[model samples]
Target: MKTGKLVIGIFSIVLSVIIGFQSMIAGLGNTLSENGEAGGSGGFILGILMLVAGIVSIVQRSHRGNAPVIMFVIGGLLGLILAGSYSDLYIWSTVSLVFGAIILIFNIRNKKIAQQ
Candidate 1:
């Protein structure tokens, strides 16, 4: 697997673990309320979505396809945007930018390898 993909996969796994643990500890409703200022079934659904996305991203890293990588990048970007818009925190946005840059670098490396 590419180094960038591996890093992103590991990060996603870690993020999933953190979010899952938080959900378990605080309950989805409370957690969402704390972070997003909203609560209820939607929060639970969002938590589930995050979990699924994290797992899928990790799994997709090992597969030989650009589509998954692209999706991962897009999802990460979206997450960052949402975080910034909703929470007014720029951390996720910065992280997302770095992650995207790393992925892009690895993609270029892969293309060069293929050409050679």
Candidate 2:
């Protein structure tokens, strides 16, 4: 398995879990207000999208397909946009970017290997 894909997949999955648990934690702590509910929902949705994209990227990389590498970049750009949109959640965005960049680098490396 490509280390790049595995790392991204794990990070995204972990982030997704964290985003999901944040809501649960807030609810358990009785800290969620009406406004907070909607506010957090965005993270939750984005987390899931990232999670799915990450998984697909990994699967594609394992198959040696180039299409999934593009997905990584798109996911990363989206994460960057999301990070800028919400200062409090830039960590996820950063992780997404790293994941995408790593995958892209690995893809380039693999292509070079194939050419050589």
Candidate 3:
């Protein structure tokens, strides 16, 4: 579980970096035409949320109990952001959501195991 959380945290930070860069450069000629500001601040927030949730899940996997729930919320927000995209951000948003869900489920299972 610790390893899983570490991997997830790193993955989430990658997501944050990617989205942050995309947002910073989104005002370019054609990038904003599709992605625009949709994935700018919103995606950035979700990415940060995922990052935090991932770290929390990892750092407190045994001590804290609600880590997976945090991830579930992040995944839901990512899914929502993906829904209103211009097809260009579908891949990024969907990928983030997938990672968030994976983290969520992994933590949930880990929590259960810890209970036993």
Candidate 4:
């Protein structure tokens, strides 16, 4: 069970990194619209947040914390708010949100088992 959680955590971290890079690359091309200036900036920030979340998730030995949850959630929200005209940004952000939820669920389950 612990190994499973670690695997998921690692997967989530890798996914976040992939999504972050994707968002940033797309962000570069997103600088041609009316809101272009704000587009890349938000994606960049979102990417950074996602990366931070990934880092946090990997650093924590116990999967029962809320730091990863919060960071990923914030990253997801930022992606949604910042994804004005970029369609890809929406997908990336949504994925980040899902990963956050996955982490949350895992954490909760871990806590429950610990209690037992």
Candidate 5:
């Protein structure tokens, strides 16, 4: 669990950094499309939420069971869904889904553990 959290946390941080960089390069006024359209900041909020969740998981190492792990899985799915446009988003989404699968498998293996 500790290892899984650490890996996911690091990946989340890297994703956040990449998104931040892209936002900076694109400028705050720039929209996802030339029509001045956007996803209404949901993507940005989700990225930050994932980063925080990862950090919390790392800090609360031993407490891993189901809920947090499930959150990671959901985050991964969200990433994949959001990846339709941004390249960095796609990369992170792929990474998250892969790592999330690994973590989910580990969680499933410990059947004796009760879900919180």
Candidate 6:
């Protein structure tokens, strides 16, 4: 469980970095476009949320409760919603969502093991 959390956390961080760079490139282009700035801003926000989720996952490696799980789920959903129009952003957002789902599964399995 700990290893799973660690791996996912690392993956999330790496994904965030990729998303950040991609978003900046996509967002900063054609400043004259009406939606360009909005998209870029959304992408940046998504990147920040991903970063926070990664840190939280790394710092809280225990299966103590649902806090971390909730955070992951929320972050993932928000990432999707705020992924902007970069198209590529959806890929990262989806990855983040998968990471969150994996963590949730880990938490559920851990709980079952504990109860047993």
Candidate with maximal TM-score: 6
Each model's total of backbone clashes: 0, 0, 0, 0, 0, 0
- Segments of candidate 1 deviating more than 4 angstroms: 20-64, 84-89
- TM-scores for every predicted model: 0.52, 0.65, 0.65, 0.77, 0.64, 0.82
lDDT tens digits, residues 1-116, model 6?
Answer: 98988888887788778878877877767365656335555666667777787788888778545555665566556656765566776676677677777888888898899999
Q: lDDT scores for all predictions? A: 0.48, 0.59, 0.59, 0.71, 0.57, 0.72
How well does candidate 1 score on lDDT at residue 109? Answer: 73
The list of candidate 4 runs beyond 4 A from truth reads: 8-37
| lDDT of candidate 1 over 1-116, digit per residue (tens) | 45557667567556545544543444454555666532222223333444454455456564445543454455445544444223322343344445556655666676777789
lDDT of 4 by residue, 1-116 (tens): 45544565576667656666766666676654444545566666767777677677766647577787787788789878987776777877887788788778888888889899
lDDT of 4 at 31: 52
lDDT of 5 by residue, 34-111 (tens): 545232242464466567656765665565455545555666566556544445555655565565576566556544
- The collision pairs in model 6 are none
Question: Worst lDDT window (10 residues) for model 3?
Answer: 23-32
**Residue by residue across 1-116, what tens digits does model 2's lDDT show?**
47767776777777778866663454443333433333244455556667786677766765556554555455545545544234444566566556666767777778888899
TM-score of 4: 0.77
Report the C-alpha lDDT of model 3 over 1-116, residue by residue, as the tens digit: 66766676677667767765664554353354754445455555555666676667667655535664556466546646643543434665566667656666765787788799
lDDT of candidate model 2 versus the reference: 0.59
| Model 2: worst 10 consecutive residues (lDDT sum) | 30-39
For candidate 6, give the lDDT of residue 77.
66
Model 5 residue 93 lDDT score: 53
